[model samples]
Target: MSDWGPVFVAVVLFILLTPGLLVQIPGKGRFIEFGNFQTSGASILVHSIIYFALMCIFLLAIGIHMYIGSYFFLNATVTPLASSSKSSENHFRQALLTFSNSKPTNTSFLSLTQIGKETTPSDRRGCCGVVFVEKWLLQRQDWRGQKMADWAPVLIGVVLFVLLQPGLLFQLPGHNRQLEFGSMKTNGKAIAIHTLIFFAIYAILILALHVHIYTG
Candidate 1:
């Protein structure tokens, strides 16, 4: 299969997974809450189950779409590519290029950092290829004016995961209080691990289905 489809899906998933991107860091100025409709632990557990179930259904749909839309079903069994790395690299390069060419709306918070700094465009591409090795792998992207620590993305992921869990909701000292939903607070490790596992499983399932569909 081509890289674009996988790249597109990865980007979509990233957006879906990181709803906290808009949120401000703990304390710089006014803080913004990330999510809405905070629920009890029981409600959250149920929601989690439902969320995962729907994700499975979505994966099934993707497999079916691949089989029907691609030449895989009609042709003899062919081994699927071992990974999505090439596709990911290409897309990241494209992203950097887009960031480079576009006029900056926010000079303070560009979408990509180190654009004109460290390396030339060609060298940057080479280095960035290593950095963005996988879709879920978090190398810092610009988030407002804040300089996210290396583990910041992981923390954001963890925080979001915690918020989704059953919890005694405390009114966090931020912009919003009376209404539940507070600013983003996450555990970096949890999010990183979750992303790695989720994407690994997803890639495996996709490859398996790709091979199985063609072989059968």
Candidate 2:
């Protein structure tokens, strides 16, 4: 993924999260339909800033998710943690530091992804516990499976952002006084339709921006 992925996520998350916040594309159409002639303005700018700040936050977090599955199998493993004779937890930190240029930071969050990439056997073999001479990377080329597994972090992050939205964090100004943007307080066909429409909007923006949620 490129920088655009975070930007797209930030924008969508802002529209979905802010209470009573109706959004308009830069050129047209109100998310809350009754608003008159929506265009770029303070409300939109502020919301953008809010989500961009939140994107910066996506880079925070000390990475408590330390240990992945142990190197009990040769069908997996990366160079860093695999490099040492013993697959200790500290080596993972060493790998992270190497990839992130000695230390992880908000800007280098994506560097962590490099640790799990499938490598050529020469790069991977003998690093971990693997004694095999056969190409571990080539033996199992499950492209679909690999991509889906790789997508977990992105999916989990998006789900967390969406799930956190309904708690009414703060009151923000919007065109709607009577209608809530995404209230879980009630269940109705209207809510279902609203969700579908929002998803459609998500699809549209994603297509328009040519955003790739995962590039590895």
Mind giving the per-residue lDDT tens digits that candidate 1 earns over 29-75? 33334443233344334434444444344433442122222321111
Candidates' TM-scores? Answer: 0.25, 0.24
Model 2's TM-score against the true structure = 0.24
Candidate 1 residue pairs in clash (backbone atoms < 3 Å): 41-166, 154-188, 155-186, 155-187, 155-188, 158-187, 159-185, 159-186, 159-187
Model number with the top TM-score = 1
Off by over 4 Å in 1: 1-44, 56-189, 205-216
